[model samples]
Target: MPTQTRRSPPDGYYRTTVSSLAIALSAPAVAQETTGPDDGEVRAEQIADERRENPVDSIIVVGGRIDPYRIAGSADLIDSEDLRRFDYGDVNRVLRQVPGINTQEEDGFGLFPNIGLRGSPVERSSNITLMEDGVLIAPAPYAAPAAYYFPAIGRMQAVEVTKGAAAIRYGPRTIGGAVNLRSTDIPADGLAGYAFGQYGSRDYYQGQAWVGGDTDYVGALLETYQQGSDGFKTIDGLPDADTGFERQDYRGRLAVHTAPDAPVEARLEFVYGRSDLEANETYLGLADTDFAAEPYRRYAASQRDAFSGEHDQYRVTGSLAFSDGTRITATLYRNDFARSWSKLQDIDFDGDGSFDSISSVFVNPEDNAGALSILRGADSFEGAVRIRNNNRVYRSEGAQISLERPFEMGGARHNLAVSVRYHEDEEDRLQNEEFYSQIGGDLVFERQTDLGQQANREAKAKAIAFYIEDRIEIGALTLTPGLRYEGIDLTRLDYAGSDPDRSNGPTRVRQTNIDQWLPGLGATYELGDAILLAGVSRGFSPPGPGNPDARAEESWNYEAGVRYRSDKVQVSAIGFYNDYSNLLGNCTQSVGCSVGDIGDQFNGGAVTVKGLELSAAVEPRLSNSVSFPLSLAYTFTDAEFDSSFDSEFFGDVNEGDDLPYIARHQLYVEAGVNMGRAAATVGANYVSELRDNPGSGAVAENERIDDRIVFDIAGSYALTDKFSLFARVDNVLDNQYAVSRRPFGLRPGVPRRIVGGARVSF
Candidate 1:
């Protein structure tokens, strides 16, 4: 008999090892051979080799390579190989290849992504859980989930997305799903490092470098990524001004671990990161007529608009594994973020003591000719153009622990895990306004107001969560059942603008408490080279610090799918439906909401969203040294309201009105040819028309974003074992289309861009 090794059970959320039953059930086409006394050692060595090849996968959401096929729900992983093919810095472009995801483009650079999973709302990506290295990365996920800051994608090693029952394991916002970004990891043994640089159109440049090594008892890593562009949009009357942005990110990691053969294996790690960004961007967009004539032109009123931000993160993690197949992990993390955006907020060109939002001016330009003329720099105006300095600071800190154990009973194997977390976050706002006058097509400073004149408030939240999950295996069938509880306390304090110091105490204070229980179940059955999966889960998204009567978004989600995999081909098709009992909408400046309405939540009554996701991939050998690889993904969604209601954020609402900003159809396709040393790929993405407001029937001309199809091509060639050259062309056809119509006027998509780069490894 073989020296049977006691293999630890797979984690409920992350890293796991392949089981013999899974191998036998999923890969029936492969031949199985009898094992000798050394088979256990050989299996352990194979697992070690796989980890060496992709260390970053250990901290991702979908676990190891084989877990995607074995999990009883929909999951996808974009490994380093896939990311290197296109070298996309914009997350929007990277996520388009994955099914069941919806993205709304803003700024054309993905600086602030609006991503939705399945049929959840896509506003600032607040309806989903976002993480980096298995930890929450949102600045203030509970107090202010709106993503004003996003990690740099150029430095990431992998991206994972999980939906259905598995998503409940990582929550606060489980209505949509969870997206986790994996960063560079310390080498297992020898020293390793890589450097990359790229230069492209519009004076754009990107560079990344990292180095890491592990000794007998210690490991360390350091990395940096930098990118900038001169921008493509031209500012009216200011041709020399650069409407570009610059970003810099830095990270450092240290790890301490016991010997590989220690009785109680343990590891402790510390990580720190910092990032800064400066951009001459704005929320003011062009009028309809101006957009038709010149889509990439910026209005004169927005010439002085700019944004600056800084973020810092610190984290510590510890893991312990016992010889009895039980594992425990704990983590502590903190994040700090601050930003200030100066842009046009309101206009009163006639000096009538009444101010109108910038969005309203563009909606009725004919009626506001005086304001429109001043905005276009065609006429001089006195002091009445208000430019707001929206300054805010955020802080988030949390601690969590998880334990997993496996046992056998009644001829069945069971994996059980429990987790607990305590988190606190806050958002502080201290903003003011500055008056400007238009003189000779140039902005002239008129007057500046004291701090806190515009807004002075703080919102905070403290929450505790508990989760438990069990995975039971019987023959070729696997079942997963999970339950979670969340208790949250929210509070908001408002100060009078006149008393910036708050010496007289807060003018008003509001507080609320909420408790919820979420449950989910998933099952998977294996049948001869194919697997069938189904799941039903409760979805939830908590409301921010708003009206006491505000209700959290609640829904029941159901999904069923089938997957087939062979040596040369893999295919999957899943159908999902989300039934909402109480849908919620949030107002923010990015959505064209007025200053007074910002941070407000509204009830949307009943709603229903149903969608189908299809994906396929195939690779065929054409010759002895050549192969062709191809993949396609498509999604169809129907999202609409089932009851009549009215809200300031969504305007007038009626039954059957479709939700805004979500397209009806999306498709992506890619094909590549790979030789021994050279490779090339071409990809295309298509999105159907989108509506800007809630309404049924034919979309109004002003509220519609026409359908668009964009093509991209990339090629790479290896010159040596450690060096390679690559080039990419985005928007190969230069198709012009409107990406969005919000916060002001029309915004255009990225034009044709060409880039060339090189990479070196050591």
Candidate 2:
């Protein structure tokens, strides 16, 4: 298996909300619950703890940033603290619960998980906009780049996701939405930090410190973390894989607040991380449950492998306040990344007997004198046979800018934001001797050997976009309306490879796509402190044909919701519907080129998705001594393909089939208990069955996975004001499932596991 690019951040909130509610619900379950910051920066050298659990239902933004509530679109927020709670094995799993989100996990951790939102997968860059600290990360607007790195929550506050046109404030690529990760506040005084743990050999460590002086440049802030864990799997016939994983995160920042009366500020920020872990291989789904239970004898061979990768992202941001409530912000950044790996597999043909390939020796045929040679009758071949090799390395650099203005009226305030971004990425893809082995045994093997080659392809793209938004506030009402425009030029030149000849156009092609406009709107209402209401302006995703000159994709969405809360209770309910045009799906093998003739092709079409999300939470004291907290969330979704041709590739999938990966129902319930210094909680999340894909490639007919329920338990005890002990157990009951299902049908969920550890502060 190969190492993948940074997965989504562990900052997703599902686990934290469930865990907290579970402890609150237990009648006599005594435990403590906790909350962490979700906005602003940590002072230099200040150790900050933050979490974004329950991101979609509970989140607030200031400074005229994106407004998630008023936009009728769908969105969610993940806090930093929640990310620390899990073993942090796979970040994508933590994000799968968000509405309109789906994942593509090919051949396990060896490949990056591609994100799909609403009905738009990451395949086309024309729609979705991905940002870090408000800067676009992808080098190209209509093209998808594996996200660079997952920033540790140790230095972050929360991740806000704005879906649909409501996300227009960020720029043109936001047809589907935009993702913004907020940085933690910088401290002014000194140093701080915390620690915690769970079952499954999991542990967490973090620390921070600050230094500031008066009448001079304020240079302050330092933060670091070390985390590791052993994993779970109790079933037989399953690989006793080591859930061994480790991470190191470091950050330093310097701020200069000169001329206290002036509204100008400058900050220098740096971040770095390295990770090493075991890559879990997924079992391709078997034909039947009974078949899955049996370890069919193989040709005396099995396969196993492990991998690791490292990344670095650095940036400098400056803020300047001009006259008349206008401000300008800009950031310059560069990201560096690298990864390597290999696999060992025992081969068996006919499922009857195991035999070493005589060919393994042609390159290094050294040892072997046995019945095996005699079995081949000695006349056909000679000597040694044992192994095979597979190995690869990839890297990029980018810059961004934005401006904003504010307006106020009748106790209400409004802020408008606009921005543009550009990036240049160079990629190198590699494969070795293994390529020759696959086509070797044939009669033309000699010719193939002579044609063996090693090469690289350099792809460069330039994307530019600008957008404007108007936010209005009047008493209990907040309204936001916006529009965006975008343009791109993409070109690929093969240094050691030739462009395949095509019947419709020149074999070597050059293209460019430009759009003058894409528009959006959003609004929100507050009914006192107990009830808040909202709805979005619109949602859209434009398509991008792979050719630089292809047409752009497009889509629109509508949504409405409300949040009701008080000191003792909180409830949120939402309903949404989306319409998509020129939606992209599995393209013909000629387009994607990975699955042979089995893959579908991309084409212009329409799709609709409608769903409802409802959640409620209560905090009530039992009798007069015990406190209980309870919460529940459920989802109902109906998504389908409207009208499309290309039957040779899609078959009968048309008009009203549910979109793949969008579960019809997802429910979670939990409770927590608190008693002085000790506390505990338990919760369960149930997901209704959903298709991993709309069935594509060779496995389409035999593909179908089922609904599953997973239970989790966690607790922590405060030993002293400066120290604590904590532990958590996940996948209780040892339920077997998969966070990702492989193309061959294998289910790969983490096995039952436990993690525990301790922390201290000064």
Candidate 3:
């Protein structure tokens, strides 16, 4: 199956809130529970020695970051310690070490990430299910899951990525996988608190503070985190404008245990986040000559662009455990958001309606010299520039219930999980376009040529999903069989653009409903302390609402892997093949989709994605108080179109054409040392060149992003039992390279930056 709470609070919340509920409901079952910088991750990493087992192959305790050996698929648990080690402001930097996941950096600040997993389209991470706690976090996940507003990773306790058969239990739209961001839970025992502050290059500032404790009956927590920067890029001749962003987050939580050992637990949480950006960003790539001269240069056209938005989330969760080994959990949640990005879209050389493509002017300077000169204000020109206001509102709400019960059958032990969810989400587009006359590098807003509304429509989805999985263990071998069912309803309403206010200039309404059942099976065999496993599953992604020509993305996926662990080292390797019957692509504003077709879906009939993932980690004792820890991860992805087709974005494609923007190779490694209360670490991230268009044409070279390796280092020393000083340097070598060629031109990674901070706890 590829596809919520209380009073039906707001939009898209239904699509992202269920994932949040799953984590909270299972809190009690995971015995490694604690309160710290990142409560959930801390709990998993520091399970009182007595309960600690081989992290690689142990299932002694269940938690947010599930162990690799405890499942029939792949799962990675990134903890607070990892975050503390590097202290990267952008989550993308931290995820580079994770195998199988791909990152496409946009703003360098990680404000809006373009990510993909297992060869799925990474345009905007719409193929994956994102959750906080265990519920969905995407705005309008059903109608549109572009992830324009991602969870604030800076405050998450831990981030969990899960794939394979087990993921069926958490989706109505499951093709790639699921990611859960755990939050700081209310303490259960002590009155604890922590505060941290940091400063760095480009006037970057950051702060995070939280306080929480538990009493005999109730627990509560209050937290706040905020950050801002002056930005790294500089515009030619526009020295007064700052290309930076400011983000703020606040969260509150309360929990009631009922009686000390009451068999039942409940918790409620509220989160609010805000972001304001004055970014000099655009979708106009520079000519090779211009890029070679200065890749960080911003176009004069994008100087007035800005992106701003806010999000609010609310959820209530409860868990019940029976004496007979039966457990049940229920969660209700809501999430709502509204955002607008006014950006330069196109330019007209004359007062006529005809317009020249921005790509032509930017990519072929010699051919379009006149246009380039006019655009850069190096020459006088009379033309009009179109600035589009990409505005949208989203809402999602849902409720989910999970039940686990153990039973004995045929001399084998069986653990069963049954889950059901009801979800609904909607997206409303209300956008405007303002026309401006440019002369001598100056812009004059003209209302006479205004396009009142670019987006005047609504799309919505409602779904019911049910899943069942049974894990049977017979001696040294285990087998798991799972099934998921999804029933979905989709609808769309459109108004003529001429009627800017949507006041009825010709209305069009459409709807589509679908049902699907997904099945998967997996098995594992143990050889001493090592494990070997394999699985096959049906993967699917829903078609967009009211798209008559779009088909659901469906695939038959197969995977196999191995894992081994010792007291000092751990290793895991996996290979996956996704044979697709159809591939679907969703249009998103960030990727330059016109506001009129922002949520449209396109089809790439047949495709295949295959890849390998490898990970290794070691901890060696140098001496009693000195030890070195090392980790390495690598991924090889081969994604291509299986049949010939034509696309407006990709131009033309042939059989076996490589998918755009997906690197064929990625690697990351880190090594560190610890001496009692002091620790240090250094790491490197590498990605091979990738193309922006599918076909291998002459322009391919210019479209491919340059390959590069980035290095970072970090260290920390304890000043006292409850205080510590930390320092880090990102891009330590300061080697500049292209990270993205979209929205256009080469966007470079953050330059060399050094930051220092101190953390205090009580």
Candidate 4:
């Protein structure tokens, strides 16, 4: 209906003071009985008061299929037993412990991070949309749409983070939401299983077996895993000299449960991957007063090489319920990817050096009058000086359709839906040449530059979207709202500087022009059961039309949050403010312009981000099935950088500042004590400190990265009901930090490690 102008205030003020104190303390809350004192553990204190009032039932496959207090926006869910007590091998560090996720490191942890939301444009925010079951695995418009490229979150069972409800059934970049990865079908009857273990040279295994009955169908799932380490922190003298990692994943699902006047019901699915790794360089480079006193330093020894090479994804989704209440659903998907990488750089010289050390400077190649010496029979010159390589390949095909029916107005009771989608993304890039060897660099004096360049880029982007949604129920009141429209087409071809022994000539690459429209909207209100949601959306990324005058980045998100559950506890709170515009970066050369465009600038003007979030959960009833769960989440951000324009050029940018990896405050706390066999959880996360990178400059600054606080402790034991046994201790007060920040100006994060495991189900 496109019409909104109600800036806040008007939605269950603590549910009208808890329904006027339940009719003014109705009979002392039922004679204040319910004795306490762990007496036979009253169902573990009612499941810890239902996990602290209600963090959505502490996890029940996202509360019997969504109704997050009637949903308006903002969502989160992570189960499958908190992914094995947080013993993750980077799903971007488990989405940085939630709360507006942010992680964009340039090195370490299997390299390639970079995922920021809310503050928008963290270098092309694909508007956020990543699905798994409903299909849609982001390969759109080329590069960077990662789900940690599969190591199979031990065979994922749950992970849904909507942030902004439905988003018109998932489209238009979700405006800044959508993260589905549900994979636990369970319908073909028979067979089910699992297995796990930990602490360094780690071990993990998974399994699933399904068989159908009554009118045949099929199913499949196989998983494999490996993690290694006889090292943990030390170069040269070695100890993690070159980190380790390994993975192999596969999945398949088939369905056909139709009959009873069949109206066609079909399904198909397949997924596969092979990930490999080697890492070391978790942000090392200090000197700002030693990173203001210890920020985890170790400088030099960068080596990470990944090879996923081939990945195949396919889907056919289905839905067709009818009998006049009409309904139709569809989805067809495809994804293919290729990856390659190499990095080998080592250095650590500063006398007193001997972490198993040595150094050299010049040897052979010549000294015939260019005067040079320091080849002390040389020591640490491990060749292959510098090499940054990447070979990419991607392919995609898409299809989508959705429909629903039912109507009635005035007297109210409507429910309508619509959706459409079409997609295409093909990209190729190859750049190689850094087989270093320069004892003399074929030179006479000392003037040579070759920041190694030999590029070859290709692109083809396409997009089309459509959406519509409505839901209105009378009585206690329920109103849902939605809308979406999107269209984009971009292409690129730079090939860097098509080498012909370039002399600064053929360096003209630009292309871009094709962006139709983008839109979004949302709403929700229930009141009776305590629900209130809000939304406003618009998102875009457009650029790489092959550089054609690159300039396309937009954002608009305004949100409201509220959710309350009863039966013993669950609370939620959200507040957002996002408004950005044409923000892209890389305008090299001391913040000027025209100079290989540094990395390619953008960020012309305007930027704002306000935030507020709160979460609470409780479950108590210490008896029967024993339970005790607790959860707390809090977020507060005040991103900045407002007004702009002056031929851009960034640099100590003013008019507000802040915003460079973002961090105003973030927190997460958890407590656990379950006994449906055995369980234990202890969690902690607190982040704050980061700001600087307005084009680097300030007592020596550039992409600042220093701020720490991360703690984790886990435990599990089931041994029956399908097996289980796990353990974890990550950074467990190993302190020493820098969560993330490093673009060229290095300083990565991720240290302190320990893992243990055991899981088996059948």
lDDT of 3 at 396: 92
Local error of candidate 2 at 444, Å? 22
Preferred candidate (lDDT higher): 2 or 4: 4
- Tens-digit per-residue lDDT, 72-158, candidate 1: 788888888989999988999999988999999988777889999987888788888999888888889988898888898889988
lDDT of 2 at 675: 70
Task: Give the TM-scores of the predictions, in the order they appear.
Answer: 0.92, 0.71, 0.89, 0.30
User: For every model in order, what is the number of clashing pairs?
Assistant: 0, 85, 34, 65
Error of 2 at 337 (Å): 2.8
Error of 2 at 287 (Å): 5.3
> For model 3, how does the per-residue alpha-carbon lDDT over 639-702 read when each residue is reduced to its tens digit?
9899998876555889988888788899999999999999999999999987877754433666
Cα RMSD of predicted structure 4: 24.6
Per-residue lDDT tens digits of candidate 4, residues 1-762?
121221223244334434533443342223224323233134333333332232221111323344574455676777666665665655655665457655444433433444555554343234466666656665543323433243344455667676644443564454456566666553344555444545552222223333322234545555444444433333322334444334444455555545433444333434443444443333223333433454443333332323345567776666655433444567777787666554322222222322211111111113211111111111223332333354566777788766655444455555566666777776665545343322332101222223225456555666666666666666655566655655555545454444534344333333443433454555667676577778776655444444334455566778887788887788888798878765655342212233343234455566777888788888887797888888777778787777544544455576676656666777878788887777778788777666545432332333455566777777777777776677777667777655443322234355556666566655
Show where candidate 4 strays beyond 4 Å.
1-71, 74-172, 175-232, 236-342, 345-386, 389-434, 437-449, 456-512, 516-527, 530-544, 547-564, 571-616, 619-629, 632-669, 672-681, 684-762
Error at 556, model 4, angstroms: 21
Model 1 stretches with alpha carbons more than 4 Å out: 1-63
Instruction: State residue 403's C-alpha deviation in candidate 2, in Å.
Output: 2.4
Worst 10 residues of 4 by lDDT: 356-365
Quote model 1's TM-score. 0.92
> What lDDT does each candidate get?
0.83, 0.46, 0.74, 0.51
